[model samples]
Target: MGSCIICGTPVEGRICDSHQEDVVFEFRGNEASQLTPGRFYSGAVDGYADFGVFVDLAPGVTGLLHRSELDRRLESLDWEPGDTVFVQVKNVRDNGNIDLGWSIRQSERDFRGALVQDADGDHEDDESDESDDAEAEVETPTVRHGSASRDESDESNESNESGKSNESNESGKSNESNESRHQRDEAEPEPSADRERVEIGTLGDRVGEEVRIEGEVVSAQQTGGPTVFEVRDETGVVDAAAFVEAGVRAYPDVDVGSVVRLDGEIELRHNEIQVETEALVSLEGDDADTVQSRLDDALRGRARPDEVTPLADHDAIVSVGTQLQDAAEEIRRAVFESRPIIVRHTTTADGYVAGAAVERAVLPLIREEHAKSDAEYHYFDRRPLEEAVYGMDAATNDVTRMLQDRDRHGEKLPLVLLVGTGATVESSDGLDLLSIYGAKRVVADAAAVDAEIEESTDVLVSPVLADADASDLSTGALVANLAAAVNDDVRSDLRHLPAVSYWEDAPQAYLDAASDAGYDETYVRELREAIALEAYYQSYEDKRELITDLLFDNGVTPDGDGENAGNLASHVSEQFRLKLDAEVETARANLESREADGVDFAVLDTDAYTHRFDFPPTALLLDELHRREREGDTFVTIGVAMDELYLRSTADVDLRAVAEAAREHAPEAGITAVGIREGRIEFLSGRREQVKEAVVEAVAEQLA
Candidate 1:
């Protein structure tokens, strides 16, 4: 028996049952069944698949590291064939399939005790160099000088002189390369050979000519014809394709995040610039450092803007300016890194206005950062949510799509930006699901804050979080300032969006800003109505071009001359007014009035009085009705649908306390508080009458 290496407790072998996971084991056994479940195993990357990667603990014995098990993302991994990696053996299936999970300690040096388990016995791994075979794995950022092994700066390290005339040119016999390398080298010289390096940003001018460029390989995708390496330098990024045989990965050593020198002919294919690679070599030591330093400097310089200054003078905005600046930096950095951004917002007028403002700002920056034309569309996405709460159903759908994209197209995990839709206790489960995969989540609540959401999100920008009053702060105004911070080039396009968001009680600062930008109060109202109408129609699609025309297209030209400036807004707004007026008139005829504790309540059974399937949704209809029936100082509107009850009041009404009171009064009503911000409550349809009366009494008791 041997004592546990971790805690010094007596054990059967090197580790106690309690501390078995404390040590990392290098499995030297040939059989997959020999791998103990729940033990960390040192393995080598065998290959990749759509679902996961194949990791071999020993030759001919491999385990599957499913993408779901990864902490970050599968595409984010820079592992190549034969690179040593660490993973925990989760399970051994009956079919001899070994399931592997992500290990926090990837390197052997991170583990406290590194052990080796083989057929003979268990002992400490003397040297972790088993995968240091003659495989061309780019494991480290150090140059290889006439060396075949991944870790070696082997015997007689000098330039080859087998066919040269000078004495310095000739050297002793070295470890020769395999037939594949010999054949590949015969077609093209090594990339380490002396050549003039050029910037990728200048490649557009040097098209149809051969050039050498040094950069980090951001992506390496194996296509049916060739393997395309998206190499990014300090200046810009470009795709360089290397071909071996059909459907085979060329330059298997090069991978994502590898600093390399590549030589190729710049050519235009499908109207996009591509490099037909002749030679590519991984750079190391000083060479890699020079390229990496330049890239880092460029990223910082390009991504970071000056400290944010609020456009309009508002105390709340001034208080949250730091969070706004941080959100802007995160967005710009994601764009620079070529990471996809998914924007989620409610399908309301404020949500659409805010989401569209950010879209306008980011599209221009995407075009400037990436050379490809579709990079703007591919990288920036805007998704509208039916409800303000980002629930488990939405999070599940997002993760599934992200995983599929990573597995199929080798795309990076998206930066999910929740605008005006992720600041509530209801959104915690959704954020937790995203946090599990290390997916970056930014919650731009703008109006309010919740501690539950704040605890889960990576970046949260809410006025209340900064100890500022959000009573007058609209979500649109907050996000417009944030969008301007992201890309100040499109600042002019966002000048009028904030004023258009407010239906009433708009800050005069925003109104004057809109008036100065050529939008009068009437024009702003028309634009708001038009967007609101369109927002509900699709309610899901971004409607990019149409929204842009209404908000930015007319004002785009220098003269800003367009007779049709108000044509679309006037046309769409007419329908918005007609549909809304019709819904209101129908609801007014069936309104039920009740007075309790010196408070007046306007109750409407939305199911009977309102066109359920038509425009001006139940909530919006109730809000409009409440506004017109403000005869009394203490007035409230309670809209009762089949199974849901919505409350809107000029006075403060605590939704949670009201729900509790109703539950106490009508215990079998099964009343539940849906959301505080939404002022929503749910009840059993069978107890709808009881729930409606109890809720009205509860609200009157508080407002009295």
Candidate 2:
């Protein structure tokens, strides 16, 4: 029998069963079922897939390391095929499928002890065997009456030596003793001369050494084994895990955003630096104020830019600088507080491009702020709205989901960001409901916003209010600039988004920006067409990964004509043209031209002439038709439906003015400008005849 290396208890092996999981093992087993779950093992990288990496645990025994299990992005891993790595056996399914988990310790030296494991059982190291054999060679002596006195001296000396030996076995300290030590450390006052306080950014240099730090608690979460508190100092943020007891809460009084002084030993967990917190105490009164002051000073110096610089030299962009700063600050605050950010954008090419730019900029910051791999999905969501309006329907869905998340998972309510929408009076009801629930709202659009919307949102970015022609800008261009202000690291990646937003004539500034970022006019057109095609197919789902692949991935060959050399835009654009051209041909054949009150008009019964539940909705179809059929005359295309009417004009038609005329002409029709920017108006179905005649007359008068 051998003594347990951890507790000095006699056992069949070197370590007791209770400590089996604490030591790393080298597996000699051939079958997958022989591996022990929750035990670390040495493995080698096999290959990578879109979902995860394949790891070979033993000869002919491979397991999957899913991307969700990784602490960092799968693409960022610098592993090559056959490179040795360490992982934990999370499970071995009945079908012989092995599941691996990430391990912080990639080297054997990081583990406390190493054991050789096999199909039958585990074995002690060679050094333990040698020591056991030597101990067995010692002989025992018999006691006599006269020799009792002399034996007493030897017995006393031996007892003293045994006690000294036990004291030297610090690694085998009992759990009760460790708990007592932690209690004592917690009760002790702040150190005066033992160790100087260090900045979190410099923790890498002081790893494995005890240090003191003063910071604010950003977040506190309990795992099955420890309570991890994310602490942030002026320099950086770090997670300090405290393990007083399994599944027990630590530092019950220290809550989020509270200033505290902590003492801990720096350690690496999951390939990231973390602190093993030995002691933590809340800083109160003057101490708290001092820490807050220091943090605020540092944040002011580094957190945001001094002034908002416009991406392009435009007067409207310059005028909205203050609002842009507010929006950027709000987004940054949400990230720091661990609050989720929900982006609601219209389901159009321009809207998707704008939303995608924000996604790209914010995801990296989310990943950096939180340790969990799924934090990106939890903290950032990009949802597509069917129309450019945040009405009661969309607001209800968002509030319901957020309320559920808050009740079920104890998550904070998310910050709702309306992109390319929610900046008009039509969406005021939705904004008011969100405000009543204390949810913050921000609007980024290129449309003419209502004056009331300015008061409804925390930050509003609308170029039309600043005297710049909204027609010359796209939502993508404005939000792209906002995204740059949110995170400067992604500025270069977003430079091409503005040009992609324009379907026909792009402003020279945006075109120049795209060109500077290496996208020419043809490439820009291809990207626009490809995105438009994809947007139409999955109108509801925000094809985030696929869109990212098409726009950002340079190595992807969508055409498959060359070895990773063909552009994705080239392939998707072909499909876009084929589908769009067919629809255009059908629309042209059914078009009817008429002149009323000396005004030329092209009218189509959209419900009867076009595919209702298919690609190119009424707004997009009319936009495309006007571009093709309008021949410089004062022309308007009225797409009539059962309950609604869509008006598109070659000349600049004031939708609000037309709506006023229609309302006066047919007061009972309830005509309203629902989509003024799109040159669209809605009419009640009950007064279809009255509304249709009024709309036709209104168009003629406006054209005249």
Candidate 3:
């Protein structure tokens, strides 16, 4: 069914529009145009071209023309699918398809003159080439030559005859048009002849250089000579050595996926490019490298340090499965000459796969090695990790210092931290809890902890939770909670794993915690205000208890624990605020109505309150104003829920600006402040005061 153009409502007559005609076009090619030209229409471009034009003019009748014919120019001339263009009919080709000619380029002479010059120059060049070839053939082949071997007597006679002819030709030397004849005699420039080509390999006698070698990156470390990359590109492995500019510089930040290109002086001892790396370039594409780098920076313990820096003594990197055990051995050997001892777990297939990538595998190594051994882990519900150390001066500052210290010992570094979504860790010292060492750690809350368990290999388990019901939640939650509980339940016997938790955004809880821990009320308020401001721009309803309960209010839900009763108070407060805002908006709109129409209105008939009530002094003045503004018959337009006073007058009120202001002020208020057109003033849905204020503002701005 056809709908109204602007509002998309069902149309009855001419679609209540101001436009003169509907835009349409002729169909061409594979697509058929459904509308007529010069009318508003909507469709997609089936095909277009490079010369600032599109081909298929009408759906089935394809043509070409400049886009300027459509009265608009493209910002970027590059064409792609989904771009729209407009055009008008130009010419109809003999092949039935319209030839959409475009003269958007100013002056027809400009194009015609340029084409003529090009054609003339080409013709002359072609004629000159032909004459040169003719002259060359006539001068060289037609002259008679005397040969000695044929006959000496005949040769002597021929030479004597030629000498006589040369003397006779001297008599005809001065000819007419000598310059033209000389030009004709010039030889044609011949094309170059073909030559045999030689292969690059034939130029050099190379031994090991001819051998194609590939190796996977085991470790990029310098063992005895220059920086060496131990890669296994698979064709029996190779240690392609890059020396100085080639070796050390090529693989500065080398990782597992780095593909090394080795074409240098090769030694045949091991069947690999064994001379120190001569030239190394990372084979990783820019996009892949960028994404991996960012992810790694966020999760690692330090920002990228020098590839050879002894950041930490090669320690045992915890991993699971045989695949990781092999990887860990490679990693540890590269980091510390010894192979890293692998800590295997009975991991699921998915778990083993998720941790297979180098990105996820390196984080726990950095975290366990970096964090303080005695770092206390607290397990509590509601507060984020950052808030847990909110007021602890020394601890908070230390965490913040480490977070902000991107450079360690003058070298930039990133910290690797494993975290989940919605789990923010803010340092008080202005350091981002997320270090650029690896992936940004965003630990999701208890509800959405499934992602965490599916990601890590060396799953840290809490000794305290050794007796807890791990089966109470999904595998994801079990992992997340176990991590959380281990980090949280720090006591004498359970001090191995650190704890992590925060109270929900009930500013009062933070304040209480601070006060009980010896913080003053003022300090508590400052922190409370900081947290409360997070919700200021949100709508009142968003803060309602009912909404929060259905959404975020459940910081940690108890499985099978039925309805949550804590949301009742928040729900009531939200309702109260919503009602208050509505009432305020209604009162203001009523006052605005009377002010705009030059009337001091008062209610006389309660039932007709939505209407003009009674003909009081204010109502009468409003009528007079309406008479001064409208251009058609004066009457009331009534609907089931609303009433509008419409009138036709011949006077000028010029309240356009006033009405616009009213609409802007109380968008949700039912009363709308309106300007009298022709001369009548009227009010739509809001309170009078708001309408009056808008009208006054509109008038002031107009006059100014």
- Strongest candidate by lDDT: 1
Worst 10 residues of 1 by lDDT: 156-165
User: What's the TM-score of every candidate structure?
Assistant: 0.72, 0.71, 0.18
Residue 362 lDDT in model 1?
A: 88
lDDT per residue for candidate 3 within 1-704, as digits (tens), equals 34322122344521223221211221322432322233322223455554445544434444555544432333233445444433445545455554343322221101100100121111112332443354346432211111111122111111000001110122343222445334322321111223221222221233434333322354443211123344442112334433221001123445445543433334432131243333334445663465345434432322222122111111111111222222233332222211122111112111111111222233233233211111011000011121211123423433443333221111112212222222112221222322222312222122222222323322222211223332122222222222222222211111110110111222233234334444345432322222222222221212222222222222222222344434332344354344334433332344222222333222112123333231211222333333333333222211111223222222222344445564677554443322121122355544544544554445444433
Off by over 4 Å in 2: 1-195, 336-338, 366-375, 403-412, 554-565, 663-670, 683-690
**In candidate 2, how many clashes are counted?**
0
C-alpha lDDT of all candidate models, in order: 0.75, 0.73, 0.28
Clash count for each candidate, listed in order shown: 0, 0, 114
- What order do you get sorting by lDDT, best first? 1, 2, 3
Residue pair clashes in candidate 2: none
- For residues 210-291, could you state the per-residue lDDT of candidate 1 as single tens digits? 8899998766664423455678887777777665432234566677779999887887754678677877888899989998
